[model samples]
Target: MLPRARPTRVVRMPDTSRLDGMTSTVTTPSSESVPRSHPADRTGAQVAADAAAVIGSADLSEAGLRRFLHGLPGVDRVGADGRAAHLGTRSIKTTAKAWALDLTISMVDLTTLEGADTPGKVRSLVAKARTPEPGDPTCPRPAAVCVYGDMVAEARDAVGNSGIRVAAVATAFPSGRAGRQVRLADTRDAVAAGADEIDMVIDRGAFLSGGFRKVYDDIVAVREVCHDAEHPAHLKVILETGELATYDNVRRASWLAMLAGADFIKTSTGKVSPAATLPVTVIMLEAVRDFLATTGVQVGVKPAGGIRTAKDAIKYLVSVNEVAGEPWLDPDYFRFGASSLLNDVLLQRQKLATGAYSGPDYVTID
Candidate 1:
């Protein structure tokens, strides 16, 4: 069993009185409780130095990484489940529901990563991303169009100045089984092809085997690739928490990725069972929250995979508000990596506007 941290109280429910008006009052941890280093404005090298400084080790050896990770606080499984279940039940009024529906649409990554993905299919997906509801101009476009690395140019061409980013999955996505050079090349190719963001999967096998330094080095290498790209694409590290086997591993992996300079720490690759759950997401949110409190560098959290409904998305929004605070409420700080979730959000948005639920055929088939 992993070492457990001192038990702390579960996160409190956020004040939601302003949700109906599209504003929220969330309570953040006081600066005195967690010292801030203001590392966000620093260069990558400075951020890396800051991470090393925080860990109290300049050399990130395997033993050093292991000691630091194990020495961190442990999670209370029962308390986490209870808090997640409690947050999921928060009621959303009509106006707030409408706002959430729109916000969910805008935060979607609008993905399609099948083995048989073609340019035409990617173009179609981009079309839906640009205008989810064709007739209604009020419909907000998705945050980005996510596709396989090879399809980055197609997605980029299709998105074309719509303000929607083009994210590509690289570093042997879904399974980080390739060699380091191959993974780096894969990332370079995607960025060269005009990808605005690169979603790289971590080596779950390495992590499970206690190769903490290997995992950290892998993310650092990928982060360097993203940083060196001509357009400087954002790097989202996919932890594939399903294979991690424990909440403790999830927290460690989250910190490892952030320390290695990942712009975002994602939950899964959407290729595994139990892809994204409230409890798991809550753990990740808490990691980012505490990380921000410590380093003053806010990292984004993306819970990909099984999220597929307007109500479910709203539940996640509530969790974001309550767990990580209001800073993560924007699309830049949070995202839903789903292909089918967009259609559901659109259906709910229509129902709110017309007072009647639209059929599945009303939206384009993703």
Candidate 2:
């Protein structure tokens, strides 16, 4: 049977009681306190410059990571998880269902990151992203195609002028254990090969050991390199929140990425266990929303891995609208990282329109 869409409600901020046992004070800069980016014609250098100004004369030493993290307002575990569960219960129906399905398709990153990935595979993925459904020209294309750095050129070449962006996962992806120099070089190669966005993993070891300075510096260095690239790719910092092990860590990592000038903060590498859960995404969304409120600079968010259904995607949109507001509903600010998700969304769209379930033969398998 087809899954029925349920009614969705506007999620209001939880009560203050939810704040109990959470961090009460945050030392992060407010909108008036932080230096604002140039509103017009901004570039990569401007991002780095604004970040430097934001980090001026602060205690980012090893000992200060905890203090800095604790200084931020704490997250209420129950409140966040409750919000996610509640939002997931929403059933989008009829025209709302159709709208959400299309919006979800638009927000997808259409990822394919496997050790065995090849040029032919990437080209096919690009074709799937562009046409989606061969007979349905009404179907919109996905936002971008995500692949490993090595396959970037192949993907880019195939996606040429289709209005589709090509994103590359770099910096020794999934496990970011490479040295800073190697990671920067990795980013440069991808950009030179025409990657519009670069997804880099952070050294989870550093973050777990309170080496926050190391983590922050690495993101800054990569951001600088991305800006300096001739094509100027946007940087997406993957925190691998499942490894972080707590909402507090997720919130801290989100802020750390934003403070380091990450164009987007991602949930996971999709190569790890427990990739992209609702609670983790919720905390990240809150971080971006709060960052925008405080710095007047908006950074995007991508929740990669484990989100497979059209229902799951729309629930994320509902969260984005409710937690981050309507501004983040656009493809520029939000994206999904998945390979099979496109087919599932296509299947769901067909089911909604025809009053019947779609078999695998009906959609493209990339």
Candidate 3:
């Protein structure tokens, strides 16, 4: 028999004064706090300038990126794991749980990236993204609907002006094995197809083989494609941390992507084992926090794969608050690249509202 649900602790909203240039706030449990819109887009040249400013007089050569990445503070694996485990134990009850459930739903990037994906499947995902809870008008929509480059147009048309973004994976995705020209074309196609955001996978092989400059150039190239687009899509650099093999490497990759002008640094492609572990995410959170402090540039973080339950999502929220501060709590700065996670969050949200669990049938099976 399943154990009865227990009350969880509330995550207190952090002070907004530390949010820097972020004008939007997410305080109350209401959906108003969920970010449904984004700030004006910047051009590719502007983004490059920002990256240059962060680089300062430092070397812009391959050796320079290598030196900088290797120079990042090494992550204490034991300490990170301990901190994440400790935070995971935090429990919230009633109102706080309700708020967290809503926030979790809002942060999701409902994704469907598969060989079997069809236009119909993408449309269903968009519908779910628009209204996660069928009858609850109060339910906040997800931050975005993530799909492949070819399906961007379908997603874009379906989403319309609902304020839900359409994010497409590009730069050859998953393996990122294509050449530079092919990868650039992939990004251009997605942007032209009206994707609001581009999630590009880094060359894990190049990164692991000490080809730091290659990886850096790959991200920079993709970022340029996003910014140069007429719509100026946001660029999310996926580090594929599961293959990165170490906590220290995760930190390096996070900083590397940020310095390369990644609007968001993602953890995985969801095609590998041990994807999106708390410790790896903690390292990433720390990297982004430190990057903001040093460069005055705020970047988002997305942990994809294996985060299916509302419980797991809440733990990540706690880590984001404790490590990166409250600024990241909003959907604008944090996202979950998940497909199954939304349905699970809906189930939990229903349970919290009605005091009774709704089985799997209550939510779509996408």
Candidate 4:
């Protein structure tokens, strides 16, 4: 006679909204709720790992993930914008201004994604990234050089050993309308080309159509492709906030990306009508702050596009300092995805060093 196997017991998580002042909610399984056999299902560990493979065992079902995002506290658009506007008014003067300018420069992901971007352009961009100001060795280089997937190898070769990384925008970048297989192939190509980081755009059509599962799965697929033993590419999920159209949607998208194993949640692709506004960036900062508080997992934030001047970049730094705290100030935790913004910061740095303001020709063209 054969012994019958015992059936495993599963229970639905209790409703968390009814709880008074619950800082953390469990719409999905809590750490203890997941089976011990599935180490990846452990909420605390998986959240901290922030790896795409871990997300496969995440306790949340498709419906649960949707509920969690929808149940998140709503954003007050006016209040958020007001706070950002007020933060913008804070002045950085003298030595403080000089320090802010340097910090801003260090955070820049100097980007060039044009179809016209050639090896020469990427090499020039790489030279600029390595030495923003050839005359002043004191001036630090920007964090990374961002390019299209096909240009990753060229960018990597040009910026070799300079400590400035090479980031490739993949997965049918800026549009994200390509099929899943094609998107995955695009990401793999970048990684195989030695891209240090991968910035992928989410399918906004799926998101807007309430295809949260599809979006999450897509991110997971890309994240998996980014992982390597010697050189794992950091994944930055771009939500394209302009197309999202609401602060609440931004917040939801931010959470969705974090849950799907995104190392960073980017604000925009910079191709759209409206890109990287203060209010939208504020919402993302809040999402990272709150997400960190609850999951003990910190994800970086990158506000791409529409940031053209040193003043605007400083304002963003200010918001980061006040909202996300000093820990997020590092390049590992924050980034500014800008092309022309780097020139402005460099010019300002020159102005601080010398008494005279530098012209456009003073800085590197790329």
Top TM-score hit: 1
Off by over 4 Å in 4: 1-59
lDDT of 3 by residue, 159-273 (tens): 9999999999998888999999999999999999999999999999998888887888888788888887688899899999999998878877887788788889999999888
- Candidate 1: give the clashing pairs: 5-74
List candidate 1 stretches off by more than 4 Å.
1-27, 30-42
In terms of lDDT, the poorest run of 10 residues in model 4 is 18-27
Clashing pairs in 2: 5-91, 6-91, 26-71
Which 10-residue window in model 1 sums to the lowest lDDT? 14-23
Kindly report the root-mean-square deviation of model 4 from the true structure over all alpha carbons. Answer: 6.8
Q: What lDDT would each prediction earn against the true structure?
A: 0.83, 0.79, 0.80, 0.80
Pairs of residues clashing in candidate 3: 8-91, 8-92, 8-93, 9-91, 9-92
RMSD of each: 6.9, 9.6, 10.9, 6.8
**Which scores greater on lDDT, model 1 or model 2?**
1
- Report the CA-based lDDT of candidate 4 relative to the real structure: 0.80
Q: Estimate candidate 3's alpha-carbon lDDT, on a 0 to 1 scale.
A: 0.80
TM-score of each: 0.90, 0.87, 0.87, 0.86
